[model samples]
Target: MRLTALALLLALPALRADEGMWTFDNIPVQKIKAKYGVALEPSWLKNLQLATVRFPNGTGAFVSRDGLVVTNHHVGRDAIAQMSTAAADLVRDGFTAATRAQEIKVPGLELMMLVSMEDVTAKVNGAVKPGATDQEALTARRNALADLRKADEAKTGLTCEPVTLYQGGEYWLYRYRKFTDVRLAAAPELQVAAFGGDPDNYTYPRHNLDFALFRVYEDGKPYRPDAILPFSAKGASMGELTFISGHPGTTYRQQTHAQMAYARETGIPFQLRAIERQKQALLALSATSPEARRLAAEAIYSLENGHKRLSGQLLGLSKPENLAKVAEAEAALKAAVAKDPALQARVGGSWDRVAQAVARQKALLAEATYLDTGRATLVGRVAALRHAIALVRLADETAKPSAERLSEFSEGNLKATRAQLLSPRPVHKAIDQALLAAGLEEARQALGDGHPFVKAVLGGRTPEAVAKAAVEGTKLDDAAVRRQLAEGGKAVLDASADPMIRLAKAIDPFSRAIRKQMEAEVTGVFNEQGGRIAEARFKVFGKALYPDATFTLRLGYGPVATYANGTGTLAQPFTTYMGMFDRHLGWGGNAAAAEGGVWTLPQRWLDRQVKLDLATPFNFIYACDTVGGNSGSPVVNVKGEFVGINFDSVYEGQGGYYVYDADTKRAVATDVRAILEALRKIMDAGHLADEALGK
Candidate 1:
């Protein structure tokens, strides 16, 4: 009991207080009871787990028995954009289906709910010897995990995902039921749903109603769900215990200082610059026409969101407090390992090995960012380079025996891959060509004017000309054309005449080689050495610490609380509808609105204001830990009563992905009362509101 004595001696409040994004199976029962004097029953835990669903991009919660899921408006934006048109722009005006028949089916929209979980650490680690090279161990682990997943899927007919927890210190086989037929039910206008723009995002005392509704359908009818979160008419109160249930995407809490520095310097900065450039390109394109504006709206939103998120993340990372905390945690981990003779012998030098790999990877990052990750600005993310790689990889991987290919191309993921590759999404040639050129140019700049890939991509042609040749020459816009090539395999790729196909074929060898190199140098070392560090941590902190987020179901509990609102200002925990209107008018560009820009309330909402209670809660702040993927999570009380819907974390909480600062970090959510009020008063969504409230 390395940690037991330290736990008692230090009496650390971080471990005791409401913290951690805990897996459903690993709830801190004693801690919860101690903090709130409330007990969570087994049945309640199961129900809560079932109620939460993982949308492709974010989290959602079941609000009705017929599988009506509520998620952030941003999460559902893609579906909405796809369903919208120039005439009936569902995204701009917002939409509310008066009847089930009127609800529009969103093609390729998918969600997943965790059905069961089983520990599989032993099976995964079974193949590796006590001591082995990082690459050997990683290759064995990946192959084993894939084989296990394939077997489980074949046996249970469920989506079997092998989740590596604590950076592979633990592993679990989580089975999920996938829902592909999701339909848009009701959504508010874009203007109101995202009431405040980028400036308001990640801010507290917010009034935005950032929520949307979708329904899961099976066999042409609404699916009856076994679990649902019942919404309360009354909102949450200050200092009350709060819980957030959702699928948080990713966190790098256990990364060493060197790795974090790489992110802070090369990775994050490069991404921010890329996003800013993309934002400008999108805006410039969207200004061409009203329809162009409509189609590019979601892209613009994504760009802005990314820009703000990365900026905030950098701010958090730069903070002395966060840096000091990381150093302290790293020091403690090292000390813990040194105290245990066996562990010290096993992992004492793991960190140095990781540092060497990090240094190597840092040099490759710029090229990797462009060619491998396809983050290159000139070629853009969705251009010919990726499309080419997909075709080549598909051909190469599918040529191998089903079990030999990577998990991404394995038998278990074919359906998902096909759905994405062959989905009938609209395309704007101008946007495509522009972004493609940007990515290509970025490749040239990062790699060099004389780089082989750049030369091949350019093919002695101008970047714009090459881009036009690729976009206009490729038949990938047609799903059937893509399917034919994908099914044709390597021989077909070799024989193909399509410009994009030929380009992919030419670059495939180089890209594949780099990928292989990356698999060994960076990913392998990080996972192999990171697992050792995690073991060291477990020795010191034991099971008291929670694993990092991995885009899975988790719950983080804290208190509904207030904090300093920056510059010695005391911020309130909650905001009301009255404050919303007051701020709107104050900042609505009238004579009194010296703060700038106009914000208008809908005429319907304005007319109904007299009949409604302006005092109703609009948004609230809580101490729950959250990150980007936690959007649309259900914010509830200890008894599992819905109080709000999570959409953003306060600026201070940007560090939440790496550290939880109880003093300043807070989760910002739209009050359930606000959603209900808007539905009943503004949107005339009375029936839907009644159903959510069980009234």
Candidate 2:
């Protein structure tokens, strides 16, 4: 009498041309072949998958047999900044290694190459007993996943983690061959790499080099990988089918209406405001002197990018019709489940439960967010505070069983945790003080001075005074001290008289309590109920729909096709090097005044312009589905050859977090030809060019 769930799924609308951040294991081979008429073979997929590498924040790929890795300049900016000093500003002058000995190892940098993956959905889901409470189900799943991670690492000696996709619909254990001995090979000046600066960040029709080179090493020698993307002489052509191989960060396209609502109201605003505060603090610090600006360079750039991106996402969420569309789809899903008694039993209360979780999240958001344990909040940005939180949490989390510890402190993650905690990266006290003071002011504003956290942190003193004391008095900046405290554990931490440590100790109780409550109430419920919702979707849609992104490896395919620019004019898919010169001139820039400001072009580029092939493509736009973490993702043709490096998406495409509109959404990438051209002629880095071309 009624249509089956499978039938309903089949009858629903077909998938769009470019719409998924698909897992490497579940690439839509048939859909890709049918849409673009390019058949992808297993060998090609495997080779590309092996070549692609994941950074902590972005993606990259090996271009030569000698492990010459390529990624965005912004993605590699931290390494460049860290390698810099008051006497040597690498960000301004750029760097090129003439020989292997010249390359410098970047501190605290790790590159993960995905070696293998195995779906463990059944193992994870089966751990939860039927009719168990959300918290119980959550704990069981975590413990189960943690055990799997531990066992896998023990067996293979590779870094391993259980990746949850489709919310909790599927769980896969990804094993990665980790590389920590990463060295910077070559990079262009910031003026060229970030040519147009913040004004042109997420826009198309741009000119930006935005590329950096790094080499992976093993035992103090270059480590060659099994797979590398051969550089294409002719990059992507108009209407050419292309693919992006990278680890896209989180996407909320499949989230429930209640979850989206919470993000729209509380989550996005809080994050956006926090970014604003950080930007202000960094800007003020930068205004002090040249050295201060240099110290604040990496942080300021990061904050500006984050602020712009969050603003775009918030704008998309603020659209009523967007939420209404989500609501309507949710209603249809509810109606579908209502007709099946078994399905109803499994997923009927999922929506209500998620709403309840959202309520709990709202209640805890301010405290949990403001008093974070070094996971990227205003308060957590202080190096000393972050280190203190790590020590505090480590003391507690490490004491618990491996399965019961917090995710960061778990056995599988301990190596990376320790590496980051004890890194010798220099900490700028001025920047730290500014950020901490701003964070405290924000806490006071958000949680009120009467709030226990604010009162305890401020201690009747001004935020500036407290921040100054903590930053100036802390010994956490010394890597040896961090190691000593970390190795000595709780006893050493308790005995420490460092002001930052003392402050961290005072706030540890409230922070830990809030985090625990959040885990049990908000996160636990979401995982349980969200898994049920995913299960219900699986019953209907099967695996035809891709999971939400979780900052894991994925392959998204599209074409280098033009789109109407919302005004009747078709946007050009490619911009040539000549256009770059024209745009520079249009912005009132010239070779003589190269150091003017944001629109400044590096002097080397102007000096070598005549030697360059001005007709070569500089930047191009494609309908590829990409987001923040997709920056530096290797853009390949159907033949699996490296063509361009994905860097940014147009502002219209910011809605991509919620929906994929193939019509208007476009990803901007720097053409490999441009990169090679500049390398050979402008920067005089012929050796790097030869290596990239696999000569």
Candidate 3:
């Protein structure tokens, strides 16, 4: 959901009661026609119902025309790397197709289209009732959706997926046809593709030029499928109806206030804390281990970016003005519910229950933070125990025949384990020590060493002694450890001689008991007030709502321009080569200089007087709604012609996922002209330029 802080700043002017229904789906087609003076096309509606291409990890776009397809540079980077060699690093040097034959093929990459959608809401909800617990409802809904998907897949040639659109009940089966032959047509240098680096990410006045071109091939030729649509640069008519067809991941708009409150209080904070820890962990490890550094780079970037965005949302929610708006909206909803006897009877207590839940969990909110740190200490011991058990199983199973040996040993398990141990911040020592200490303390406090599991694991040794040996004496590199399990086989499994194994057996039941206790306490409070809040929210916001975005395709539109939010005026559209030079100069404590950094352009750029390009005002900003998943989305003119590629939104704009404003809702997009110019001249990727521009 968009953060309430930004929502308050861009609050729509109060509208008459009648205007509410106009934006809602209830309004007739004629009413929209009369107001917007444009006929809503049946084709547009059909297109809206279609799904855009999406990769396994959320990267894809529709087939635009014939073989032409669009997606983000970052998304296609892996494929580009796979197709490249040290002598031809597409990521650093970029690629361009001078002609159709020169296009680079990406093996195993694919495109998918949503061919059909069936509303399965009734089937899902029928499995569980209104009074059912969340877990029960979730399980029931999942099972029903699975059954529905299986049935649909049997009938249709395409793959069918049953998706929950609005939490548990609102479900739809989206059918898709997959194509696996996609190729790269063009790309830009990292300098241009990720222009602003980390600082400009998720912020406005974005200088990023994040776009990549690819094409779909079938039978060794350009695929001209029926799904491809011709590019239309004119865009939709101003003030006219338009529809965006894409795979929108998730939205939180439909969430009850109680759920949102949970997010605001418990969920977001926990996420922030976890992210912080991860970032720190990555940095510490990266400082020493080159392999670890490379492996953690992507993870660190994702975590840091998410942390920044969520932090913005939390700050937005904390604003007094925003809270007031929420309260006012809730009050109005309650009034509406009180007026409707039926609704009141159905949802009267929901809000109170939700509130009680929130109140009860207030103290326990920090539990997640504690667990985040604690888990790092516990997981290693668990892993060691599991590894030992696996070895014993492998030995027992190998007695049948040489060919019957378990696959685990031949696999990369040992190699991966060694690499993990070599990481600068290996978790083994800490985890073993923490688990050993905690287990011993618990045994002493509860049943003493007499408890069978405790006696088997720790009866002969003190906690301190075990901890010291585990932390300082244990050698992860010891071959004997692997051999001992390999030889012992069934004997090890039958005996409880291993302390780690004994502790591991007890941990699950202990953890479950703790979780149950916590849930019971929380649910009891929720049963009191949660229901009342949910009902109140529904009355105020109505049934049609958006869910939280899960980094999926969503269409957001606004104008082009910069914004001022006390951080300093963000120059809209873009920063020029001159500005890049200036930034470098400032960084080097020489801002007054005219020429001394990476921005020193090629002779051609200089010959053009730099002013020719910088002064042309080639860029425009808009409060277009976007999020992380929105990256690489085409920023089109009203006629739906691609003008630029959407990359990042500003920090202030992070909250825009929920609430959009005509102001402050800007996305960073690379201008099509600049991209073309870079390809044609700077990068000498004339072939790619020709295909992209249809030259």
- Relative to the unseen true structure, what is the C-alpha lDDT of residue 434 in candidate 2, on a scale of 0 to 100? 94
TM-score of each: 0.93, 0.95, 0.67
The numbered model that scores best in TM-score is 2
Tell me which residue pairs clash in candidate 1: 377-438, 377-439, 378-438, 378-439, 378-440, 379-439, 379-440
- Which stretches of model 2 miss by more than 4 angstroms? 1-17, 374-376, 590-596
Using lDDT as the measure, what is the rank order of every candidate, best first?
2, 1, 3
Model 1 agreement with the true structure over 16-49: per-residue lDDT tens digits: 2256899988899888898778798889889889
Between candidates 1 and 3, name the one with more favorable TM-score: 1
Question: Once model 2 is optimally superposed onto the true structure by TM-score, how far is the C-alpha of residue 690 displaced, in angstroms?
Answer: 1.7
Q: Candidate 3 lDDT, tens digit per residue, 112-181? A: 6667667777676687667876444544555566666666766886766555443332466777777777
Q: Which numbered prediction scores highest in lDDT against the true structure?
A: 2
> What number of clashing residue pairs does each candidate have, in the order they appear?
7, 0, 45
